[model samples]
Target: MKKLIESLLRQALSALPVSRVPPDARPAEVDVERTRDAAHGDFASNLAMRLAKTTRQNPRALAEALIDALPGHPAVAKTEVAGAGFINFFLKDTAYYDEVARILADSGQYGRSDQGGGRSVLLEFVSANPTGPLHVGHGRHAAYGATLGNLLEAVGYRVTREYYVNDAGRQMEILAVSTWLRYLERCGETLEFPANGYRGDYIATIAGQLHEAVGGELRRAAAEVFSGLPADEPRGGDKDAYIDALIARARALIGTDAFRRVLSVALDDILRDIQQDLGEFGVRFDRWFSERSLEDDGSVDRALAALEKAGHAYRRDGALWFKSSAFGDEKDRVMVRDNGVKTYFASDIAYIFNKLARGFDHLLYVWGADHHGYIARLRAGLVALGGPAGCFEVRLVQFVSLYRGGEKAQMSTRSGEFVTLRDLRREVGNDAARLFYVMRSNDQHLDFDLELATSRSNENPVFYIQYAHARVASVMRQMQGRGLEHDGRQGLARLGLLVEPQEVALMKRLSQYPETVEQAALQRAPHLLVHYLRDLANDFHTNYSAHQLLVDDPALRDARLTLSLAAQTVIRNGLGILGVSAPESM
Candidate 1:
């Protein structure tokens, strides 16, 4: 209905004389919005007021002229020139009736549109390092990113979901050394683990598997492993330095080949576990991009060469530095350290380059809130490499703190004391986890109340919405039990009988779903859809209480059932996008 009105307004604008309104005065896209007050009209637009200054005409008079020129349409009952040149349009009841019919006809694809024009998007998210199992923080990334992808595709965007594996970093090295130490412990070698090592029970599990793979072949005596190691953090020394020294000693004792074997075993086990956890949670990626691939494929070298050739990089303090400060960074960043190893930023720079090279029209990076500072430098790298500024975008997801029994659960990946995504999912179920994770804006802090989420009462948003859907199904089952069949075609034909206030309100809310989906997709906000479904459910519940669907009159009964089924269809479609289940029974 909104689109039809916008088209009619455009026809009216085209009908206006060149002397009265010039081509440049016309808006590129017509803007017709639903009015707040029903007395004013159903929809309103301020085109006359917007063009008054440029055309030097009275806005009210211009509005009247535009209204007179509007094309005839059945959806629009009437048009009025409201105060200060506002064009108000009142839609006929048949307009909403047709919308309900459309909803039934389209079914699951009701609210989908081609607003995105099929532009390719590479969405990289939840690239948590394969050091340990994913914690609660990464759950937000997975849920948010997956839902965002569904929303984009719902609006016809070509979206590719990606997970970048941080397999080549100090963290990976730490995980490797940690697993090796545990492997020695399994081989009857008593040793004290480094303070910076990953202390999760999973590391010991991986070591047990490693020992099964190569029994004592890669293990050394405890004294040989820690003979000359620096003092650990427990001894008042730096934990990072001690960890680094421990990593070096591990390599020297086991040899680089044998050390890499330990690293590979740990990496494979952890990566496999991460994959299984995410898959079970319904979060799947189109690609698992390895950071090491950037180095193996010479992408990092290519990126640095491009920067150096473009004069955006120079040697400073015997290290290669990118002139990021010149491109809005607070200071220049190092591409390679003085020790002749490429820094993590070098991988970041190359990763963006690689994404662009893959022919993605846009790069949407979903990063943790702590990565805010990296946005500027990464964008600078993209711009320096001749990529469009608009092509690069980032959405920072805030931290997730889990509360159970009125206490905040502590999370530390290295300390191995954290709530994993799998743990949360197992407790609250995936439906609640998926919906609650996105119930708030990505930029805002979310306090996931487990008590509310698991409760069966109306306060639980997920349960409430699902109940509305099941309630409709219950109505149909009752109809069948009473030996009555709903005539959908007849009900659609006699939609005029649905004139009750509650019925009218449900139809109006149904009309808003398409707009809600488009807005949510364009704004990258899934919470909008969440709120919409809640409101829709509330309206449905209100209507269900006010009127009985299995009434005596067959025409009214079918009509009411048709409306109820339409509501159920929409709820299912919406929940599908959120990766949530819409059960037929609680």
Candidate 2:
């Protein structure tokens, strides 16, 4: 409908005489937008205001000329030059009636578009390290990313949902050593666990599995393991150094191959857990790209080589450095340290190169807000490697603070005290979890109120939206109980009977679904869709509360039913994108 209005305005502008509106004064695109006030009409455009300055004519006069030139269309009931220069378009009642018919006909496919132009987008998100189970924070990323992916896909983008597994480097090593220590304990060898090592009970579970797989063959005596180890953090030593030393000592005792086995076991177990958790949350990825694979395939070396070839790399203080500052970063970054170990940034660069090599027109990274500083360096690295600066984008999701009964819920992943995504989903349900996770802007801190999410009330947006869907179903069932079948054909034919204010409002809201989806996708804002759903649900509920659908008048009853069904279809489609279920019975 917006397109139809825009097209009419564009044709009107083009048909105008050059003397009144010059070729140079024409806009590349018409700007038709929904009016906030019903008195202003269904849709309005500021084309005249935009062209007035260029055409050297009064905006109101230009608006009048534009309106006069507009070709007559059945959908447009009238066009008025309103306050100053806006062209307000009052859509005909039949237009909305046709929209209701279209909604019923399209069903689940409604509100989708081909606006993406088939561009390939590699959306990498929630690439939280596989060292621990995903927590409440990761749950937000999962919901936001998954919904964003669904939105983009709905708009015809070839979106590849990816989870980059940080399965390499110090963190994974710490996890391996942590698993080994726990395995040793399982083998009856008591040793003090490192302060910086993973201490989650899940690690102990993995350790038990390891013991079952290899018995005590991979275990060493506690004395031998901690005999000459440096003081741990609890003993007034650097936790990072202590953990690193423990990892080395474990490798020496178990041998390099056995150490790799331990690392692989821990990595696979935790990765599997994360994959399962996200999958159960309705967040599936097209690929789980491994950081280890980047090194194993020589992509890291190749990426470094590319930097060096482009004169963006230099050696200083026995470390290979990339001149990231040259491309607008605050400072240069080290790619490889003095110990010949590559930094996580090195793997990130390789990952970027790998993504580019795969032919993605755009690369979007969903990262934690704390990683804001890393964006500049990563973009610099991409540009240093000759990738287009515009191709790289980052969206930082702020922290999610869980609250229960108005008290903050504290969490720490390393201490094994954090609320896992599984726990959250179990507590509030996947539908509520998904909806609440994305109810706010990604960059805005979210206080996920557990009480509100679980409450079966109108205040809960998820429940409210789902209820709107179920209300329509209940109405249909009631109609059936009264021995009246919903004749969709007859309902569609009698759409003209739906002329009440509430009915018109609901029809208008339904028509905005496609626009809402498109706007949310383009803006990378899932919160927009959430707010839209809330408003849409409110419209449906308002209409339902005021109007009686099962009336003695067959045509009016079916017309109202048709409108309700359309609302239900749109709510279902929106909820589906957000990974929230629209239950028939809320």
Candidate 3:
């Protein structure tokens, strides 16, 4: 029905004089919307106002000309000019019912399309450093990224979900040193736990695994091991410096090769922990591109060379820096430090090239809000590496704050005091958790009120949407029990019986699912789908409450059944896009 309305609008636009709307200034699609107020007519558009200046005529006159342009389609009864310059369309009753049959006919595939024409898209998200378990803030990216992937796929874009593990740099180096320090104590050489060491209890779990792997060769008496260790406080302890010192000591005790092996084992343990946690949290990645792989492939060095050749780079303060400010960044960024260690930006530049080289048409990087400043440099890095400027889009998702029992739930990783995604799923269930992430725009901060989310009220949007689906199921059951034969099985040849005003309004909303998917994918906004689904569910409920699907009249029963089936198809399809279930019974 949405498509049909759009077609009708194009027809109207075509009929208008070339003087009013230029041949190319016309809108490609016309929307047959359900007005919030009945007095505004069934559906309205301001294309006339948009055309008035170009046509050099009053908007009201232009709107009238547009209204005169709409012909007698199988669906539109009439279109009127309203307000200053709005085209209000009134769809015929039969046209509304026709869309129901089309929707039911499409079934689960109702909203999907081949609009993307096989273009491949790469979606990278939630690339949190594997130093610890994922916190709530990362959960939003997981949800948004996954759902966006699904949305793009529905429109026919091949999408690969990826997580770039930052396992080749200082953060990982620090992690290794921290684990070794913890392992030393288990080996009986008591030492202070470095303040810079991973404070989460998960670190010890890795250390214990290292001990098991060494067959107690790393074991030590507890008294001697912790002898010089400071009490658990901010301390006179500088964790980073202490861990760096311990790393040096380990290299001495067991040559560089043996110490490197131990570090590898520790890294393996930490990486395993990360993979397990994220998997259980429902973030599935198509690829775990190792940061080391880029270095091995020479992409890092090659990318640096490109920057040098492009003259986008130079040495400053004994560091090789990319003049990112030349390309609109706040300031230049270092690709290599004075000591020759590559910066994270260098690694990312290589990774970006690797992604495009793999043949993805577009690259999307989803990062946490704290890293918002990195977008400009990353884009700059890409340009210096010969990739088109602005080809890469970096979306920063604001953090998530968890509140349980009306108080701020402290998330101090140092104290082992953060709620895991597993904990959130356990408390609120997966559906609620998924919906919570998309409840707001990605750039907007979301205050996820646990109490409100858990409540079984209209305020709980997930349940409300689900209930609409369940209610349709109930209607179907009721119609079946009434011995009413449904025309939805064999597409209804005649739908004129569905003439009620509310019926047409409901069908109009039902027909918008596909266009919503396309628009949401184009804008890279999943919240639009969220809001669209809610509106659709509300429309279904409104029709369900005011009308009966299984009326005594067979003609009416069949028509209504078609409408109900369409609603079911749309609801189910919508839930699928969100990675939520649409139960046949509930």
Candidate 4:
């Protein structure tokens, strides 16, 4: 409906004489908006007032001229010049009646559009490290990213979902050592675990697996493992320094090859678990990028070489540094330490370079809110490597606070005292989990109420929407039981019978689906679609309650059924985008 009005307005503008309205005064794009008040009109535009000053004419007079030049269309009942030269359009009832037929015809493809124009996007999200299992927080990231990808593809964007594996870092080393310590304990060697080590129960389970794989082959005496090492945090020493020294000792005693074997075993086990968890949650990635691959493929060296050739890198105090401050970062960042090891920041830079080298039109990163400070240096790396500044984007997802009953549940990944995504899914079905996770904007803090989500009532938004779809199915069954059959052809021919206030209201809501999807995709907000579905469900319920679908008049009954089916189609399509099911029987 908005597009139709805009097209008519464009025709009117082209018909206007150039002497009265200069080409510069004409808007490049026509903007038509639905009026808030029914008394004004169905839609309104302020084109005349916008062009008045440039055209050297009175606003009201210009509006009259533009209205006169508008071509006649059956959808428009009348056009009026309101106060301040606003052009108001009162649409005919047939405009909305035809939209119902369009909806049923399009079915699953009704709300889709080609707004993105085939642009390519590389969307990276939920790239949690393989140090531990994914908790409730990562679950929110997965749901939001998956739905956002669906919304993007609906609007015609070519999207590639990715999860970057943080496989090369101190965190991985710590996990490896944690597993080894537990392994030694299982081999009759008792030792106090480091305060800074991963104390999760999963670490012990991995150690059991290691014992099953190589029994006592990698085990060492507790004295040899902890001897001469710095005091641990529990003993009033720096935990970071103690953990680093312990890692070095482990490598020395067991050899680097053996140490890497432990790391590889732990890494493979945890990564496999992550893959299974996400797969069950209906989140799949096109690629699982490895940070170590940047080093293995010489991409990091190439990135450093690019930076140096572009005069953005220099050596200072025995360390290679990137001039990040020149590109809007707070300070210069070191690419390589004085000890000849590349820093994580260097891998970050090369990662962005590799993404751009893949010929993506845009790079979108979904990161935690804490990583907000890292955006500048990363963008600096892109620009220093000669990528467009506008091609890079980041969306920060806030933390999630899980609530069971009234008390807020506390979570810590290192201690493994947290709720996993799989745990949440098991308690509440995936439909409810997916819907509840994205019930708010990504940047807004979410308090997921497990009790409310499990309830089977209208208070739950997912239940309300799915019930609306089921009611239509029930209506069809009831009609069949009454020995009647709906004739859609005749109903479409007799759509003029649908003149009730509830019918008009429902049809108006149905016509807004395409626009709602386009706006939601452009803003990258799934909550907008969530809000729209709720309102649509409310509208469907109100109409169903106020009228009867299986009436005596065959034409009216089929017409009502057509409307009901259109609503069902839209509900199914909307829920499909959110990765939630729309069931026929609630």
For residues 395-449, write the lDDT of model 1, one tens digit per residue.
9999888887678777777778888999999999999999999999999988888
Report the CA-based lDDT of candidate 3 relative to the real structure.
Answer: 0.77
Q: Give per-residue CA lDDT, model 2, range 1-586, as digits (tens).
A: 8888989999999989998877877879889999999899999999999999887789999999999899999999989999989999999899988888898888999999999999999999999999888999999999999999999999999999999998889888888999999999999986778889889999999999999999989877788888787888889988888888888898888899999999999999988899899989989999999888999999999999999998999999999999999999999999999999999999999999999899999999899999998999999998988899998989999999999999999998779999999999999999999999999999799999999999999999989999999999998888889899877899999988888899888999999999999999999999999999999999999999999999999988888998999999999999999999988875
> What clash count goes with each model?
0, 0, 11, 0
lDDT of 3 by residue, 1-586 (tens): 5566666677878987776578877666555565778677567787777777666679998888777777677677778888888888776666656667778777888889998898888899988777777777777888899889999999999999999988787777667766766776555566656666676777777777787788666544545334444343366656565555555555655567766666677677767866886676566899988998888889899988888988999998999999999887999999899989899899888898788678778888888888888888888777766777655887788888877668777777656678777677778877888888988999888887777778888878898898888887887777678675566543365466666767776777887788899888888888998898898888888887888777777777777777777777898888888877787665
Model 4, 112-216: lDDT tens digits are 988899999999999999998899999999999998899999999999999999999889999999999999988889889999999988888999999999999
Give the per-residue Cα lDDT of candidate 3 at 211: 79
Give the TM-score of each candidate: 0.97, 0.98, 0.90, 0.97
Error of 3 at 557 (Å): 3.5
Candidate 2 regions off by >4 Å? Answer: none
Name the weakest run of 10 consecutive residues (lDDT summed) in model 3. 224-233
In candidate 4, the residue pairs with backbone N, CA or C atoms under 3 Å apart (3 or more residues apart, or in different chains) clash, namely none
What C-alpha lDDT do the candidate models reach, one value each?
A: 0.92, 0.92, 0.77, 0.92
Local error of candidate 2 at residue 351 (angstroms): 1.0
Which portions of model 1 miss their true places by more than 4 Å? none
Ranking by TM-score: 2, 1, 4, 3
Candidate 4 segments whose C-alpha is farther than 4 A from its true place = 53-57
